[model samples]
Target: MPKAILKLYLILKRERFDIVQYSTTNAVFYAATASWLACIPVRLYAQWGIRYVVFSGLVKIIFKQIERWCCRCSTVIEPDSMGNLEFSIREGLYPRDKGRVIWNGSACGINIERFDISQKDIWRTEYREKIGCDVHHLVVGFVGSIRADKGCNELIAACRSFFSNMPMARLLLIGDKVFYSTIDKDLRDWVESSDQVIHVPPNDQIPQYMACMDVFALPSYREGFGMVIIEAEAMGVSVVASNVPGPADAIRHEVTGLMVPVRDAVALAEALQVLLRDPAKRTAYGVAAAAFARDSFEQKKFLQYVLADKEQLIAEEEFQINHAGKHV
Candidate 1:
């Protein structure tokens, strides 16, 4: 680790880079250490989300200290969500004044033009048919990684409960089932047979899949920000998400979509039922959601935020050249 840090320091020193930007905490530590060692003028860290739950107490503390150290070395810290910014400030990870909020809290916004309602109908027909769903059946879809931390188990449980009551309802999961546990095997195998559950792998044409759902569900316990929610909304699909930090930021309850309690399968089931039973309400929500997403989470805004101050960064390079010339 020390040798790697020294190598990074030498590279940064040779390149004479300005405004070094680090994406994750581990990267932040390396950048901070390198910048301090090489006397680099500016450093910045992007705090996307908290990952303390994934690690133990001592490791969490160590990671927090690294975050603080990186923040101290950097000129700015870019937090993805309001919740994250506030948490960073509270935890002394970054100074309140230094942290800047990017629009909509997502890494990037969906391409609204490409994800049009006109392109959705064909996908809707095919996917519904594949799941044995008819016009009368309500289809709910989840488009992301099939991991336990993403509340996949909770979703499966909720769908199981819903299936017992409403056989006409279908839940389609569209993503890679990469992170399967021993406990998940029995339930997952059962879902494959009995329930109206379909496990599809990762595909390039995700927007097409988003088009097929009447409702999109993301009951994740933690997220930096849920990007698929925005995509689903752009494709005119209403969503049901957990009332946690990141999902709450993405979805406006009773407007664009519905939000339920974290880890509460019963609440999730009830929320799903609301959309399943009322086709009119679902349509209204989807329309409103697409509009809201278009207005608030535009791709142009994401580019503007991410590309802000680039000209200034370039100008700094010119200024440094002129100053060095004068001295020489």
Candidate 2:
């Protein structure tokens, strides 16, 4: 870790960058510290999500302190979601002044044109057939890591209970199980054995899978920002997400998607059933969701926002430099 920090510090010093941004646990901690030491004018720790929330006791304390240190070194603590910024400030993790959330709360936002494949009916049909889905199937899809934190277990249980009545219904789970997966044995076994569930190893063809889905679901326990929900929205897929910070911001309950209580399989099942049963409501939500994604969370707009922010910060930095020079 120290060597990596030193290497990053040297790179920052050599580059003399106006801004340096990093995310995740180790990268944020090391890179922020390095950027601070290198005296970069803008050291940004772009926190994607809070990992320490899942831990407890001394372990959680340790991780929180490490994150606090990382934030201290950073000029800005940029959380992707407003809820995350509020949580960090409320917890005293970072000075409220230093924290900010970018437009509409996503890591980078989604490309609407890329996910706007609703017109590609042929590919959608072929993809569904390849994934073992029949024309009769009512597919609900999830795209993310398969872990306890992601509420994969809850989704599995919910699908099993709910989809039993409709054998034609399918659960399409994308992404692979990580080495240290905290998800239930039921999820692990079901992924391999269950005829009702279809598992696709983690790949880049998410929009393709999204095209085949009737509904998208994200029942995460916690999230910095539910980027996947926005992606699904871009694909004109109605979602059922957990009523937590990240997903809450990504989805508007009853407007674009439904929000169920976190970790509650029954509520999750019931919510999914609503969309599955009511084709008209589902279509309405999907249409609204696509409009929302295109209007607010387009990738180009977000990139422009970030670029403008950097330009403003650079101008401020230059003014300070000039002011200091005149005084000297």
Candidate 3:
């Protein structure tokens, strides 16, 4: 850690950067420490999510201390979500006055043109046939890293329960099976063997895959911001997500989508079943979700907020320097 900090310090000093920003916990620690050492005029620590939420004991303490130190070293603390911003303040990780959230709270807001529903018909037919599912099949999709922390096990269980009632419903699991060796053997075998489940490797055609889904599910244990929820919504698909901080902020329960208790396979399955049975409700939610996403989570609006914040910070720094010079 010391060596990494020193290396970053040298790089910052050499570049003479006007502003230094770091994202993610690991990067925040090293970059903030280095930026402090180099006395960078503006040091930003972007808190994407908290990993220590899932950890405990001595390990959690160590990580928490590191996060606190990173916060101390930074000139500004920007969290991607309001939930996370509140969490950081409650935990005393950073001063509330020093923190700010960008727009509606996401790393980057949805690109409506990219995830637009206009191409749904074309992409749905192409992807559904490629994945061996008929057009009439009700597809439930999940896109992200397939691991325990992402609630893959619970998702599998939910699909098992959902399939018992809606046999024709299909589960389309996208993304590579990261940490596959660490996952339980039984669950791994089930995913491989189930004809009702189609596990596709990660691909760049996310917008197209999202267009093919009737409902999108993300039963994650933790998330800084569930960007995919908005992405799915932008593509005119209703969502069934865990009632966690990030997801809760993104999804308006029973309005844009349903939010079930985290790690509860039964609730997750029941939510899916409810949407599958009611085509009218699904269409209603999808339409509302798309409109909500466009109004609240547009990329242009988010960028404007962020760029304006940066300019304000820079102007404040210049004012301070000029005022100090006059006093001298």
Residue lDDT tens for model 1, 32-84: 88887787766667766667644568997786677677778877777677767
Candidate with the greatest lDDT versus the true structure? 3
As a whole number from 0 to 100, the lDDT of residue 295 in candidate 1 is 84
Residue-wise C-alpha lDDT for candidate 3, range 1-328, written one tens digit per residue: 5899999999999998878989887788889999999999999888888888777899999988988899999999888888889888999988789998888899988898898788988998998899998878999999998888887788888888668677789899998776766556787888788888998889889999998899999999989899999999998899999987788889999999999999898999889889988999999999999998999999998899989989998999899889999999
> Candidate 3, which ten residues in sequence have the lowest lDDT sum?
176-185
Taking all chains together, each candidate's TM-score versus the true structure is 0.88, 0.94, 0.96
Off by over 4 Å in 1: 54-56, 130-132, 182-186, 312-328
Candidate lDDT scores, in order, read: 0.79, 0.87, 0.89
Predicted candidate 3: what Cα RMSD to the true structure?
Answer: 1.4
Measured over all alpha carbons after superposition, the RMSD of each candidate to the real structure, in angstroms, is 3.2, 1.7, 1.4
Q: Candidate 2, clashing residue pairs?
A: none
lDDT of 1: 0.79
**Per-residue alpha-carbon lDDT of model 2 for 1-328, expressed as tens digits?**
5999999999989999988889999899889889999999988888898889878999999999998899899988889988889889888998888988877778888887778655646657888989988677899999988778888889988998867698889999898777425867766676678798888889987888898899999999889999999999888899999987778889888999999999899999999999999999998998899999888899999999988877877888899899999999
